[model samples]
Target: GAGVSQSPSNKVTEKGKDVELRCDPISGHTALYWYRQSLGQGLEFLIYFQGNSAPDKSGLPSDRFSAERTGGSVSTLTIQRTQQEDSAVYLCASSPQPGTGNYEQYFGPGTRLTVT
Candidate 1:
C-alpha cells in the first residue's frame, strides 16, 4: 500500500537538455495524474491515465512533454529539450476515479527542476 513516490526529489539541468521523471503510485490505483506547480502557473494538470484507456494528454505544455503508462501500473513522464521556463515542481497523483471528482488525486512531494 505504498502511497506514491517520485524520484530525484530535485533536478538541475542546463537549457535544452532533457529529463525523465518517474512516478510510482499506490498499488491497485487505477487513475494516475501529472501536474506542475510553478510561480506563474499555480497548478496545471499535465496528463492522466486510467485503467486500460488512452491517456489524456490535453494538459501537456508542449510536444516536448510526453508520458506513458506501462502495464497499467507504472508511468513515466519525459520532458524533452528543457527550458528555464520549465523549471517547476512536477507532481504525480493517483486515485480511483478517471474523469470525476476533485478528490481524485493524492500528490507526491514532486521533482523540483531547475534550469539554467
Candidate 2:
C-alpha cells in the first residue's frame, strides 16, 4: 500500500560527478514517469514507461540523462557528469493506466539535487 517514493530527499554533488536517483512506484501500477522541475519553472516531462511497452524518452535533455524501470516496479534515473543546470527537484509519478487521457498520477516528494 505504499505510494510513489524517491530517495535521498536532497543530494549535493560537484560538477562532473555522477548521481543515481531512485524511485519506487506503487505496486501493480502499469505506468511510471520521471519529471524535472527547475527553479521557478513548471514540471518538465522526462522519461515514461508503461507496462512492457518501449519507454518514451523524448523528454530527456541529453545523453547524460537516463533511466530504467526494472520488473515494472522500481526505477532509477542516472545523471552522468552532473552539471549546474541539472540542479533541480527530480519527481517520479505512477498511474494505474497509460496515455495522456484523464488518468491520475500519484507523485513522490521528489529528490532535490544540487550541483555545487
Candidate 3:
C-alpha cells in the first residue's frame, strides 16, 4: 500500500454498538502501531505489532479495545461496547523497524469515530 490507509474515515454509532476499524500498512514495513487522538490532543499509543510476534497492547484503555495484525500487513482495531468517551480519531502508523535509532513512523489519515 501507499503509506497507511484506514477505511471508513468517519464513523458514528450508538453508545453500546461495536466497531471494527481497518488499517493497511506500507508494504515491507515490519512494525505497525495504533493510536487514539482526542480532539485537540496528542496521539496516545494503543498497540504495536512487530512482524508476526505478539503485539504490545499495554496502551489499550480498557478490555473493550483490542487489535490484531494478520500476516504482518493488515491490522484491525475492534472497540466493543463502545462508549461515548471512546469518540476520537483512530490512527494507524508503520515503520521499517522497531526501536532502531532514528526510525520514523508514517501515519495514516486517521478514522474519526463518534459514539452517540
Candidate 4:
C-alpha cells in the first residue's frame, strides 16, 4: 500500500562533497527509474531497473554520479563530488514493467539538491 518515497525533499551541500539520495518504490512494482531535471531544463534519464535485469545508467552526467537499486525496490543515487552544475531535482519513478514498453510511470516528489 505504500507509494514511492524519497528522502530529504531538499538538500544543500558544498561543491566537491558527496551526497546520497534515496528512493523507495511502491509495493508490487517491478520497474524503477531515476531521472533528473536541471534548472529550467527538461527531464533527463539517469538510471533504470526492472526485476533482475541489468540497470541502464547511460544518462549519468559524469563518472561522479552513480546509483543502485536493491531488492528490486529501494534505490539510491550517490554523487561522489557535488558541483553547481549538479544542482537539480532528482526524480524517481516506478511502474508495473519498467524494462518493458508502454506502461506509465508513477513519480516521486523528487529530491532537490543544491550545491554551492
Candidate 5:
C-alpha cells in the first residue's frame, strides 16, 4: 500500500521511560498529522505539519509529547517519561492538501504503546 506507515507496531515500556514512534507518509504528501487513541475513545489530534509551515503542536497533551517531520516525508513522535495514562495507540495520517474540496486523510494502522 502506498499510504502512511508506522513502525514498532507494539511497544511496552515502564513508567518514566522514553519512547519514540515513527511514521512514513506517502510520497509527495504535504500535510501530516499525528493522533492518539485510547481504548474505546476517539482519535485525539496531537500535531500537524504542512509543507514548510510551522507545525501545529497545540494538541499535544503535555510537554512530554512532541513530534517532528523531517524532509516533509518522515515523522517521529517522542514521549518522554512515559506514564501509565499515556498507554494508547498512536496514529499517523497524511493528506496531499489541506481543506480542499476533495481533501481526505489516509491513516496508518498505528503503533500501540503501553506503559506499565
Candidate 6:
C-alpha cells in the first residue's frame, strides 16, 4: 500500500523554461488531486482527476499550466514558460473515493519548484 509520491523533490529551473512534475497516486484510488503552495500561502487547488471522467482543470492558474493522468495511475503536471510567480511547492494527493467532500486524501512530500 504505497502512498502518493512526487518526483524531483526539488526542482530549480530558469524563468521561461518549461518543467514537468510527476506524481504517482496510490494504486486503485479513484481520485487524484494536484495543489500548489506558495510562500506563506495556503494550498491552492490546481486540478483533479477521477476514474475515466474528464479532469477538472478549473483550479489551474492559467493556460501555461496543464496536467494529464495516464491509465488512472500516474499524472504529470507541466508548467510551460515558467515564471517566478509559479515557484512553489507542488503537492499531490489521492483518495479512495471521488469528490472533495468527506473523503480523506493522502498527500505526498511535494515537489518544490524554484524559478531563478
Which candidate tops lDDT?
2
Give TM per candidate.
Answer: 0.91, 0.95, 0.94, 0.93, 0.96, 0.95
Q: Root-mean-square deviation of each candidate, in angstroms? A: 2.0, 1.7, 1.4, 1.6, 1.1, 1.7
Prediction 5 global C-alpha lDDT: 0.95
lDDT of 4 by residue, 14-101 (tens): 9999999999998889989999999899999999888898988888889999988888889999999788999999999989864457
Better of 1 and 4 by lDDT: 4
Task: Show pairs that collide, candidate 2.
Answer: none
Which residue pairs in candidate 3 collide?
A: none
Clashes of each: 0, 0, 0, 0, 0, 0
lDDT of 6 at 112: 99
Candidate 1 structure, TM-score to reference: 0.91
Q: Model 2, residue 2: what's the lDDT?
A: 84
What are the per-residue Cα lDDT tens digits for candidate 1 across 31-109? 9999999976788999989898888999998999999989887789999999899999999998875455556577788
Compare candidates 4 and 6 on TM-score and give the better one.
Answer: 6
Q: Which stretches of candidate 5 lie above 4 Å from their native place?
A: none
Kindly report which residue stretches of model 4 are placed more than 4 angstroms away from their true locations once superposed. 98-102
Cα lDDT of model 6 by residue, 17-109, tens digit: 999999999888889999999999999999999999999999999999999999989999999999999999999999986554758989999
Which order, best to worst by lDDT? 2, 6, 5, 3, 4, 1
lDDT of 6: 0.95
Candidate 2, overall lDDT? 0.96
Error of 3 at 46 (Å): 0.3
| lDDT of all predictions | 0.89, 0.96, 0.94, 0.90, 0.95, 0.95
**True-structure lDDT of candidate 4:** 0.90
Residue lDDT tens for model 5, 1-116: 58789999999999999999999998988999999999999999999999999999999999999898899899999999999999999999999876676588999999999999
